[model samples]
Target chain A: MRNLTEEELRVVFEKLAKFIGKDIKALVEDSNENYCFRLQKDRVYYAREVVAAAATNIARHNLASLGICVGKFTHGGRFQVHITFVTYLARLAKYKVWLKPQSEMSFLYGNNVLKGGVARMTENTPKNQQVVVFNQSEIPLGFGVSARSSLEVQQASSTDLIVLNQADVGSYLRDEDHFVGCGL
Target chain B: MDGVEVDLGSLSCADVRPIFQEETKQELEERIRRSVEFLVHGLFTLPEQSSERKSQRELPEPFSVIPRAKPIPKEKPLTKWEQFAKIRGIRKRKRDKFAWDEGRAEFRPIHGYRSINDGSNQVILPHDPSLEPGESPFDLLKEGKRKRIASNRKNQERNKRSLSKNQLPTHALRADKRSSKSLERSAKIVSISNRSLGKHEEGKKSKQKLSSTKRSLKKSIIPNGVERERTFQAVNDVLKNF
Candidate 1:
């Protein structure tokens, strides 16, 4: 594993900031442990400093993975957040959308959340803003970008798209091969 | 009595101690006062030039007794021209500040303020055989001057960019914040508000999606083992709000 370059960190932070906003700072700087972001095979991993330092000793090719794989940098250098990072995003997300019981299955199936499925959402969530998707029980299922702001969502038709699916729990099964390759 | 050695140049006196074993403090003080008076008298005796009720005395250069406060300044690095001149064994000759202007028929400054070399002062231009039918030499001169100034400005800006690039990445990033902090904050807000967290929107050029606040995130990729403490401090700050 190696340190993320400035450009890579910027992309990662920008993606993370979309959901967590300023809480991205809390992820890097924690009171319990010295956490950091490392890049291994273009995969961004959030790990403790000691773990990252120790991982450096392992042969670059031999090392399968280090810490939690938050996301991976595409060949184009764009950072795509994986479902694995949903837990942290769920906790720290500034804007969140809750799905109804009937809509949870559709969201888990990797479908865009329809307006009818959105039971509630954080107030003042702007359109195209990244938001963590949660069930009515408050368990975060995934995260996506809002197709409409909270005010606009009310005006939108029931069939209109609310949250544009970016990543969901369904990816764990669908994209299992990719996750295994990343040692997630 | 032992002879007292006093150097007026350094304004220091040596051997001012009691010459006699029975000499009183008053006698020592009296001797010092006399030495100071002698120095003052010597200063007044210097050659003087009187003009308009003011007499200017030519005081002899005083020899310094103490070492310099700071070390001698280092020699400045030579420019490319200077280096080239050195290689060619070109001894610099001081040019006269004033030069005779043939056209003006008068002595003018060689540089700056109505200088002899200033082409703008010329009224009748030397006709060029290669000139276009309607092209004025004055306009050509002005254009050339403008191009020269523009190139110089471009080079200066390039030099500044390269200088900042050579600096440490962290320092360079910090340099951006040297501007007004509130202005930067508002600029960041505008960037974010442009298109949903500043993501490049459809039908919009990539150039339009400029996000400036991303730099505020953790700059360094590797943790320096102090993040935990920072987090603890952050937690404390949050708790303090309660």
Candidate 2:
């Protein structure tokens, strides 16, 4: 579980940063696992993917600050990749702009009521509602560059990602419909 | 008309009389059988139509529609099963008419009627719980996190669909007057983004500076100090110098 040399990790980060720069501010590879990279941003994104490889090809997984192992499934195949990331920024954006405001409309219909369990945070939400708050829960949406491609190194080809942020997502959502379910 | 001439010489009464009498007897028997069938099958019935026919014949000439009502044409008396069916049919038709009238009355447009969800004139904030009428449905909706999110998404989708309908090229929805301006504004913003990212490069470069200034202005407007520290410093410094 020795860390990859600074050079090796830098190459991977640079390659990945180019694809999802809007969502990922930076990423780090720690010395706790082989072939594992920690993706960093305002909030850690939950990385979920469908990956297929031979028993000898890969070893472990990690996402920035989250030590919890995300769920995984395997099929008898040589190559596959299905991934999902639940970012705190994304969750926060959803709560503030989409979910929290909806509570005011709860008395009207059966479907609008908020089941009491998961804590929520948002502006304009009433004081009585009791929401767990976070100061760094924001995602930059419209103001970023995004790209996905394969980068061929000397021995193996890895999928490269890059993202760049330029605009405030809050304003963009204001002009557009703010209430979207799931990750848009 | 001289009561239609009868050629008795060519037609023998011997053969004809027996045939007529036999037919009359058969018809009388059948009529009696039907009367018995109606009584035995069920009490409700058309009482002896033959008697009704006889009474009609006895009425003053002016009161009769047919002078010779073609003697009911020897119909076989209703079988017991048929008698029951006829009575049931009459009752069913009467019941149907009554039910139909009752149902139709409910749907009729009353002079000043209003519906609970009337979208007729303007946006009615759904009966607010804050109002005295009842705890608003919105409150029920607010109780569950999952339900609340689902409802908001549904509402947004409905609004989007309605907006699209209103902005249709030729036929706009007259009912969406309140939302038309806001929808148009947002539609323009969407068009700006969707404008093929490839068009008019020279314009984009010239407009780039304008956009950056707008971005800076937006950053300066953010209330959080951490977000706009540099802009706040510049503003404060200018204010202090003044």
Candidate 3:
């Protein structure tokens, strides 16, 4: 609800650059609370929340980017660090690993990936590297960390204990999963 | 044993048996008696009348291939208002079983009594693979191997030309730079050879300058984490203005 000044904007931008790992070309604030932070004219992140103090700390600490989080207007009442879909996509575009439909379902359900489900992975992907998980159509489904390097995944029969899932778009589609269906 | 009658000739055997065994009186009586019994049995067994046969004979023969009968005449039960409504309803009613909703860009009546399950809508389409970190399908790789088993003679000739160009000494490259045509020819030559030109040629060469120009023109081609490291140094340069 609060507006950020020029000085605060600079701090936010610096934090975003650290988080996004790219130079933010421009930052445009809309009439509403929604903020469009441009990476380029075409590529932009619509940040829903911005807190100058938190952003300053994020930049100072060099914390790994959590994309856009619901920023606290006041200092440290409660921080809602949410990974926005745009950031999800950015991660997916770069650090990607493909999952079979079955693996995709499992990953969406917040289960860790097992061996042999990865249809493809980025070359030179070292073991334990963070990866974006994608479905067969190549849509970025979520994010995870790889259990094995790309070469090991290929050479080794099982990527057992591979790709531990962090977040997935399936969360939006599924309920709390209070009751499971028999796929009836 | 005391009264055994051995002499049957003298005994009255003719009197014991019938005096006239083939007599006409006996034959006529036997024949008359058989005739009377037969007449009585025939009269009782025979049917009195054939009423079914007479009725069947009286009726006309049915047609072997009968034509379908005409429906009975009837008047329309609907009123004028009702008939008009019925005709008006036909336009929409005549529509295909599925009605498309342009607003949603999907079929209307999605939730229906008849339509129990819509798994297609339920299924999530994966993001386009091109959007992911991958080599473009259109990207012509430095392909050493042939796609097909059969060798292309034309390709081989192009390859040979490229090989001959590569054999040319590094200093010889400058001689071809004056004419744009040679540089264009070199690009074609390089592509066919399926190998990277030396690092010196990459810097000094003028052929396929578009490839280099594009590389320069594209500021942010790669997205995501890779972009982070590549652009990290540049970030400070850009941020210095602030």
- The DockQ of predicted model 2 stands at 0.01
**What digit string (tens of lDDT, one per residue) describes model 2 on residues B193-232?**
4355424444433232212222332332222233223323
Instruction: List the DockQ of the predictions in order.
Output: 0.06, 0.01, 0.02
Deviation (Å) of B94 in candidate 2: 99
- The Cα RMSD in angstroms, rounded to one decimal, for candidate 2 relative to the true structure is 36.9
Model 2 lDDT at residue B187: 44
- Candidate 1 chain B: worst-modelled 10 consecutive residues by lDDT: B165-174
Query: Number of the top candidate by TM-score?
Result: 1
- Chain B TM-scores per candidate, in order, are 0.48, 0.16, 0.13
lDDT accuracy of residue B219 in candidate 2: 30
What is the CAPRI rating of model 3's predicted complex?
incorrect
lDDT of 3 by residue, A1-184 (tens): 1223333345444544432333254233213543332221112223433432233233322433322432222253222112334343454244578888877778877788777777877787878665677788867776767788877776676657778876666655564341122111
Q: Which ten residues in a row have the lowest lDDT in candidate 3 chain A?
A: A175-184
Among all candidates shown, the one with the greatest DockQ? 1
Instruction: Give lDDT tens digits, candidate 2, residues A70-136.
Output: 1122233111111122232333221232223333223112122222211232333322221221222
Q: Model 1: per-residue lDDT, tens digit, B39-147?
A: 6766667777776656666655566477899999966446555678999999999889998878769999997668877788678888899999999999998898789
RMSD of each: 17.4, 36.9, 43.6
Docking class of 1: incorrect
* lDDT score for residue B39 of model 1: 69
Candidate 1: the clashing residue pairs are: none
